[model samples]
Target: MDNVSSVIEFTLSGFDEILDYKLTFFCLTLLCYCVIIMVNVVVVVTIAMDRNLYEPMYIFICNLCINGLFGTAGFYPKFLLDLLSHHWGISYTGCLLQGLVIYTSVCSDICFLAVMAYDRLMAICRPLEHSSVMTRQRVAQLVCFSWLAPLGLLSASTIFTSRLKLCGSNIKKLYCANWMVAKLSCAATNWVTSTTPGNVIAYVIILFYIFLGVFIFCSYVQLTRCCFKSLANRGKFMKTCVPHLLALFNISIASLFDAMYMRYGSSDFPQSFQNLLALEIIIGPPLFNPLIYGLTLSQIRNQVLHKYLQNK
Candidate 1:
């Protein structure tokens, strides 16, 4: 195939062809990106600088914020330019790097969230041991591993992707994504087909062990028991857990569905649904993840508020 074919570059049929929302989309996306960066920066910096946020959970939050910031950093500039110029022209290396950043960040994001869940489980289930178990050393190790795993995956995948020869004009969807980039290849679709399964299986296994089998089940059981024991002060526990639970649920659903869509329904899906799904998967979680940590989290909120008040 390589001998027979010349390398092909993709021609993205711009979103303006069907929807003339380029300028509008550019403004909206820029605003959203700005908010995402600002909020996440404040949250991460506050956690790092604040004396009260020196604990394991806050450290996890810091990692989460950092992942999000980097993840958005990878996509927003290119996306913003595409939106403004309505030019979806991207080189092979640039597209590959975008995919690398996205996959790396996404893989790290999910892994870190799972780690955070485990941390929370320890805190709730074994409060006495939580301090020792979720130490700074351990949290740092987890963050390192989270980052390294994705980089490894991306490296392996990129090797295979780089070998594929492209033919004809590259056809792309509204966004720049790995699978979309891969589809433009004249070579076999095996990479695209295989990528989702490997990632989903890895995450699902982690989910099974950490979330389904242990954290979710055990934590809820203990949390329930605690709530029942504190009948008069039920609201206290609820207030603490509500935001984290919601955040996890949101991330899980969005991530899981994204994986599923990529694996099973890529070609069969409607363009509009595909567009919306991609947007939701990309932008929605980043927009909300910080809110889940910053606004709902008492320590983060308190620090932010205190800083704001002092500045005022």
Candidate 2:
């Protein structure tokens, strides 16, 4: 309890064991961040500039890339600095802000994917009604919902977490997360008591993800049924839905790995493996989303290539 009042910063110990290879890791991380920015920027610019690509699907994808940039910007710069510094510490306010940014970006990502799934569902299962349902105004509304819902949810969670009286100044991971900050609250205090604010917020987040998972699952099931009914539907599924599905799966697995590891990870595991798991969510999806969509979506790929040839 004595330690609670003086704790103004958290020491991130995740990098302690990696000092031997810090320079190597720093270069790789910088390169990866650069590539993430460049690739996502290209996709976003290409889509935004080409009026022909201004459909509901491309709009959703452009939003996804923007989110990738938003999320990684919250992490990579700080991470690169940490790799170069002797000590890894973050002020309390900065920690909360980072958690807010990263968590909201992630939640927005899943929300976008779910909305994209619904978009595909309408396209395939209700083709005749697709245009009527997914009008530009409607797409704009959905996009706003995707960004706002997560922002509001995570903002509440972060606010609740900030109210907690933390008793420790050590975070195990390289980055600040809401759960990590919540874990630092004094166990004997009112804030961490049974049904405390932190617990309630955590439960809300879990429930939200559960609801999202169920919604996406049901949407995909219906989409699968619809696609199986006709050759034309199958082609539509392969053409647009496949890339979304692939991106969804990639992010899902990455996020799940990080979540499961955070909840149940053992100290017996190698630190490198632990670090890799911690990094998967940030690295895997941001890098993969653009590449997957760029390669698979013919319109995007052709536009990118045509632009490249024109410059060449």
Candidate 3:
């Protein structure tokens, strides 16, 4: 207990084997971070500035871009610093904060996707009623739920985590994660046996993802059925729903790689490969979401081109 009290930081081991290429990795990471910021900001600003593009679908897409920024911000700065200094450690408080930001951002990604799913379902299947059903008030409520629900869930997990007496001060990954931090507690076994607040919150978080996965699946299933029945509906699906589906697929694969690596990763794997697996979620979505949306959403793409042409 006393030793736990004295521990103030957790050492990250993800960068240990990359020291030989730190300079190259740092430049690549810095470039990647800047690109993520520029692309997502372009989509967000395009949507915000154009009143003609104001609609529920565009609004949700904008929120998704904002989330990509929020989630990546938790990681890239700290990672860049570690790459430069060769010091891969975070303060205990910093670890929890990072964990909170990263997890909530991921959760919010799924949440927004689910909301967008529902919006598409309404737009394509109930086109006549889409305007009334996805009203301003309703869109506002869904957007708030997408952010606030995850914030509340992750906050509870973080609060419960703060109560544990950590028995270890080393983390295996590049950034702190809630599950990794929870695994360090002296009461790791008790997290499963004694039903502590941390364990309860952890279970709820898992169940929430399960529910979201099912909700998204069902939304898309019905959407597919509706699209198949009519040619016009299929065109609508191609124009609008395809981008969301592509974004969902990309983020899902990246997130699954991350979750699988966290739970089942082994030292037998090369550190560089392991780092790639660990970083897939943060890297892929932040870069791809903006590109996916900007290219596929005709209104946004045209607006972006118009802005560029005007500048010229």
Candidate 4:
């Protein structure tokens, strides 16, 4: 690193393991991306076109689908091209922007899920006040919180990453991780120096997720408590809350995989296995979540079934 400051681009070797299987990987990846796009689009369109489905839950589901598209676009396009082309590198600025899109999308998802949990809690626990409490203004605030919180948090993190004097240009797994970039700091820069900004903000993000997980858990507990009190509450829980719990379980598993691997990934692991773990967070959730919401929510299922999904 004679001139470490001059490093302009980072090489992504996540695809290296599958070079011989590029055709198979590309086809599978492309098919997955296509289905994600198609399902999300259908769900969004169903929710938007049907005024009857304009409740807070549907509104949140719509935002979730949009964010799914937002998060996946950050990865799949560049990844698909990398599979075809010779080079597998992204410029520094591009890397920052990609990290920004993917991360904001990821964090915002948890925000939306938390908001949905609160919405469910209110609808079940305080049924009489649910409509008044979840006014248009309140819905707007929660939606904005979902998008803006992640944008603000990660923007600060990106600034810290951009200021580092990096000694390396290779990112072992796919896509740019701000922490991984920070991990490449020059010999003079200690990985966990007191001067490091990431240490503080990294804890902030961890705390944010922990707080949200607890919030969601508490909400569901309250929901479960109320469920036993009435047959109607039990029905509502079965219809709405159960799907949300399933979605949360899926996202938690995906995020857990990425977080654990990011913190403790081993060089001894096969590259293909490493790449699969890296992709777990971004790939599966986007494709599956909309399906979870769409198929489970009766209003959405009915609308879609009556329209495009019905017999010819």
Candidate 5:
């Protein structure tokens, strides 16, 4: 039967597959996403209209809002629908598109964070060159590459992964992960394994290792320099750098753990743990980006309040 038969579509076990916690999980996730979206939207609005927030940092914040918005959009709709219906069904093309957008948003998120880190590094460590180094043209170029590089990577991923012949059961995690899709392949092991490098999981690790190494070294050096300054100047420097450090902490922990989990633990770990890890992909950055940036920037807080009053 194994050799003779073939497969078509995949099925997913909805979060409510066990029962009882359906409504609770639904309400909690919905509330969490609502907060994430609202806060990011406020940041975006403040950056757009507030004259005071027209700086490199806030511009990066705006870009982060857009990425988080689209990224959540890609996952939350299906997640919500699954909660409502207690069934998880996505079309083949739908799965592909979801994977594509989710990966793109993720890659874009990485690029933006790296850009933000470099921006902070220049401002803190190379203050004289801050303006000249991160000029409008340079910032525009960086942002463009952030958006474009993901497309290139994802295109390579989608093409190689799609060519493999999926056999029968398509039921993956609540979402369509590329590796899980590859698991359904009837093709030879080599063909399936060949697809790993093109997958999102692999590239995420490669990019993060490089980025994280550089980020940690740069941040530590900057923090060390700040420690030696006078209390007043040091406090000012710390104020600017603290949020970035916090953001780096959040990104580093969530990304490193999840990447490691997906790579090494997918098979060994329990299904529940794997699912939780996948949720981190959606929830971690959304929760941190606005909170960290808002806490750090006075201008952002003022603009947010100003906008709230004007809308009222």
Candidate 6:
């Protein structure tokens, strides 16, 4: 410990390649961030204002949009600043906070989507009990749990990262990642041990993915059976289920790329490709969800468009 220096700030090296075109990247990133905010806000506001939209599904969709905004907040501003500035460094404390927001928000995405899958399964496969089971108070509880659980767990993980005596100052990531920071720890070899919170989170999340996957699959199989039983159910599935599937597919693919790159990525990979993987999960869902959900869900689509035209 006497011979080693702890890292005080982390230099975000991920932006170096793209920083050559800083002016252009800054503008484009700003524009993208603005669009993400506008679309997600519209969806959330539309759902909130319309009394007709006060249903379990709409409420959950509103949360999804809100979460998208929340997650991106941790990335876009810092990213934009880095894009325009000569310095791209974040303090040690700041990095931990950013990592907390980014990681929990992404995991929260999975949680909300799982909640949505449950909502659809109930509506389709168990229509009679759906109303009773998915009461307003109940949905509120589910929402609270979905958000709080990840926040709580990751906060613990962040504490572990903070206690680490990091020997390195450079994080090749655009944003601080739990694993990346852990790798910089003076005790890097055991940072991922079973005793470590980071390792526990990794195991828990993998199990969470498998459980949600099976649950969604079974829910869909039942949904398919019901859809075949009646034309009305089939039509409903086509409208509602398709977009949910699209969102799930989009998030799943994006998360996979991010996880693979985070754990296995190295400088040997082209910086451009590394950049793509880092930004893909962060960019794809927040942008993809509102558009897909807004276009596919008729009431939301109509309400959003009506408000847009009225303002124009």
TM-score against native, each model: 0.82, 0.95, 0.96, 0.96, 0.85, 0.94
1-312, model 4: which lDDT tens digit per residue? 343357799999776888899999899999999999999999999999999988999999999999999999999999899999989999999898999999898898899999999999999999999999999999999999999998999998888778777778988888988877877778435567733576788789889889999999999999999999999999999999988998898888888888777866645877777877888988877988899998888889889989965655
lDDT values for all models:
0.68, 0.88, 0.89, 0.88, 0.72, 0.86
lDDT score, candidate 6: 0.86
lDDT score at residue 14, model 3, on the 0-100 scale: 76
Model 2 C-alpha lDDT per residue in residues 94-201, reported as the tens digit of each score:
998998998788888899999999999998999899999999999999999999999988998888777666778888788889778877777634545632765777
1 or 4, which is superior by lDDT? 4
Kindly report which residue stretches of model 3 are placed more than 4 angstroms away from their true locations once superposed.
1-6
Cα RMSDs of all predictions?
4.0, 2.1, 1.7, 2.0, 3.8, 2.1
Off by over 4 Å in 1: 1-8, 17-19, 187-240, 260-270
TM-score of 6: 0.94
Pairs that collide in candidate 3 are none
Clashes of each: 3, 0, 0, 0, 5, 0
Task: Sort by lDDT, best first.
Answer: 3, 2, 4, 6, 5, 1
Off by over 4 Å in 2: 1-6, 188-195
lDDT of 4: 0.88
Task: TM-score winner between 2 and 5, please give it.
Answer: 2
What residue runs in model 5 are displaced by over 4 Å at the alpha carbon?
1-8, 14-18, 191-216, 219-223, 226-233, 263-270, 309-312
CA lDDT, candidate 4, residue 74: 94
Error of 5 at 220 (Å): 4.3
Q: Which of candidates 3 and 6 is the stronger one according to TM-score?
A: 3
State the lDDT of candidate 1 residue by residue for 113-193, as single tens digits.
Answer: 667667766766566898889877898898897788777766666655665555544543555555565565554455445
Better of 2 and 5 by lDDT: 2
For candidate 3, the C-alpha RMSD (Å) to the true structure equals 1.7
lDDT of 5 by residue, 148-235 (tens): 8876777666666666667755453677765566666675466535555455545674775586558756766865675577565466
